[model samples]
Target: MRPRLLLVTDLGYPAAGRTYRDEDIDLAARLRADFAVAMCHPLDAAPLMAGFDLVLVRNSGPVLHYAEQYAEFRRVALESGTRVFSQLSGRADMAGKQYLLDLTAAGYPVIPTVDRVEDVGSLPDVPEYVVKPKLGADSVGLRFVPRAELGAVTGQLIQPRVPFRYEVSFYFVDHTFQYALHAPDPGRRWDLVPYEPTAADLAFAQRFVDWNTVDHGIQRVDACRTEDGDLLLVELEDLNPFLSLDRVPPGTRDAFVAALTAALLRMLA
Candidate 1:
């Protein structure tokens, strides 16, 4: 019998610059050849996942829309040993944005982050700073403020707004780099094109994959190139990262599918 996979997603989710359903649709179709794949909305995942051999979440939209349901799904999956792609535990975006502040404190080359409003001084004295909630995703609830006004909010992070030239993302499967895509126009976040990553670029992205500790799952390390020609971490997305398969070449897309298929099989093994 084929492995029964429950693919969690929100078919009707309205993403800002991309189609959430289209990507998940392609992924579900690709995965169907290897497993008995069925797609469902994220809110129904907790109750429906019991019948599947594995639960693969892709483009499920932000958990902020259904935080309680997402919590319960995580709880049941962890307690029952229900295999979840990207796993139920990840230290990066999966566990809120706290890693940003932690990594900053550890002196990792990341956008300087401080959770407490008073600690805004630790960031560079830039004209503007970014303020966002720890649990925010998809730039939701994010605002730009002057450094002096950072203390107006509590329990949020402050970082100097970098004037990035372009943004690049490194995609990986099971710690192996798959392919990369970048936003050529800095203002257009999702207008992606295939990127050829240098060895040094791969090394920068690989560090976060090593830190995540999820042995078998997809991850995307997002970084931005500063005006000084340096790259700093933007986000490490370990949970249901939207792979821009449509942007990559057909061969690269096929490779990604093959890599993901093997990872899923290994996960169930």
Candidate 2:
């Protein structure tokens, strides 16, 4: 029998610069050729996971929208040993934005980030700083404040407003590099095109992928090119990362699907 797959997602989620439904629908159609697939909203994932061989969390929308439900799903999945793709061991976005602060403190190339008022003074003095809820995603709850106004907010993270040239995303499947896409215009974040990464670029992206705990599932390493041509980590998305597969060449897209299918088979085995 084909593996029974429970794909969790929210078709109606109003994600910025991306359509959650179209992507998930396209993925489900592809996976159907290899598995018995059923789809449901993230809120409903907890109860239904028991009946499936694997729970693939794709574009489930921000878990912040259903914190209680998401927490319950975690508890049940962990207690029941329900195999979840992008397993709960992820220390990045799957947990929260706290990883940014941790990476910054550890001297990683991430934009300097701090969550406490006491540490705000340590960051380089930029004219404007960014503040976002520690649990925020999709730029939700992100705000800008003058440098002098730092430490005035609580339960928020602070980072300098980077004057980066452009943003790029490196996609991976189980530590294997796939294709890349990037926004040439920094102002038009979603206006993306195919990007060809240099050997150095691949190494830079792979470093974080290596640092992450996921031995399965997709990962996207998002970064920005600073004015001085340095790359600073924007975010590490290990959970429900939007592949933007529609933007890649047909051959690359096919390769990604094959890799994903093999990963799932290995997982089930």
Candidate 3:
């Protein structure tokens, strides 16, 4: 018999720049081929997760929206030995934005970031800086401020808003890259197109996927190409990253679904 999988998601939740419901619907349909799949909201996961052999969290949106419930789900899942995709073991988004600060400190090719007001000067001098909540996602509470206004926003850690040439994202399933996508227009982030990644680009994204150390799950390494032709890490999304399935070629999308299906099988095994 196929293993029962609890697919956790918020299908009705409206997200900016993308549709969360459509992704989950398509993914669930594909996953049902190999498992007895059931879908539920993020808030209901903690209570429902125990019934399934593995729980798959997909497109649930930022956990910050339901922090307490998410914490409860994590606590119960770990204690109960319930397998969760993008495993609770994730140290990136699962742990919050602190990883960005950690990467910055370690000189990773990331957007230089600081979390404390006093360290604002450590960032490169630029006309403007971007600031947002450490636990925020989907650009929630994100703001850009001018150099002169820096002092007023001193309490917030800042990063020089680099004028990146383009944004590219690397999608991986259990450390193996599936495909890539990019937004040619910086202002139109969700207007994605299939991206052909070079070996070097794969290596750059793989570094974080290796560091994340999840033995099973899906991850997206988001980065931007600097004006001088260098890629810097923007965010490592190990949580429910919205796969731009709508943007990729049909063959690429099919390959991704196959990868995800295999990963889930490994997790259950």
Candidate 4:
């Protein structure tokens, strides 16, 4: 029998400049070819998950909206030994934004981040600083403050407002590179186009993929290209990274789906 897959998503999620329903609907249609696919909102996952063989979380909106239920779902999945795509062992965004602070201190090419007032001095001196909740997603609670006001900000992650040329995202299925997309216009983030990454770009993205613990799931390594021609880590989306399938070429999209199908099979095996 084909594996019963519980695909978790928030179809009605109002993703800024993106349609959550269209992407997931397309993905679910393709996935049904290999497994018995069922769709559920993030809120329903915990109660309905046990009946399925695997739980695939995709674009479930920000977990911040349903924190308690999301926590419950995680606990149930872990304690019940239920399988999950991206696995329950991810150390990246699946956990929170703490990795930003860790990666910063370790001197990775990330936008330097600090959650404490004393550590504000460590960041680059810039005109403005970006402040957001450590546990936030989808720009929730995100704001920008002037340099003078930076030290006054408390209990949220802080970073210098980087002047970048473009933002690129490298999509992967279980550690293998699939495709990349970039927003040419910095002001229009979701307006992405196919980006041909260089060998160095792949290496830069691969470092985070290697550092992350998830062995069998989709991941998106988001990075920004600075004016000085350097790439910096933006976010390592290990949990439910939105794959902009509609934006990619048909061949690339098909290949991504094939890679995802194989990853799921491996997990179930």
Pairs clashing within candidate 4: none
Ranking by TM-score: 4, 1, 2, 3
Can you tell me which runs of candidate 2 are displaced by over 4 Å?
none
Best by lDDT: 4
TM-score to true structure, per model:
0.98, 0.98, 0.97, 0.99
Candidate 3 per-residue C-alpha lDDT over 161-211 given as tens digits, one digit per residue, 9 for 90 to 100: 999999999999999999999999999999999999999999999999999
- What is candidate 1's TM-score against the reference? 0.98
Against the reference, the lDDT scores of all candidates come to 0.90, 0.91, 0.89, 0.93
Would you list the clashing residue pairs of candidate 3?
none
Please give the distance, in angstroms, between residue 236's alpha carbon in candidate 3 and its true position after superposition.
Answer: 0.3
Q: lDDT tens digits, residues 1-269, model 2? A: 88999999999998888898998898899999999999999989998999999999999987888889999999999999999998888999999998998899888899999988788788888899999988888888999999878758788998989899999999998899988899999998888899999998899899999999999888999999999998899999998898888888888888888899899888898
Q: Model 3, poorest ten-residue lDDT window?
A: 149-158
Worst 10 residues of 4 by lDDT: 147-156
TM-score between model 4 and native? 0.99
Residue ranges of candidate 3 with Cα displaced over 4 Å: 154-156
| Ten-residue stretch with the least lDDT total in model 2 | 146-155
lDDT of 1 by residue, 1-269 (tens): 89999999888988888888898899889888999999999999999999999999888988887899988999999999999998767888888998998899888889999888767767788899988889989998999998767668788878899998999999999899999999999999999999999989999999989988689788999999999989999999988888989899999999999999999999999
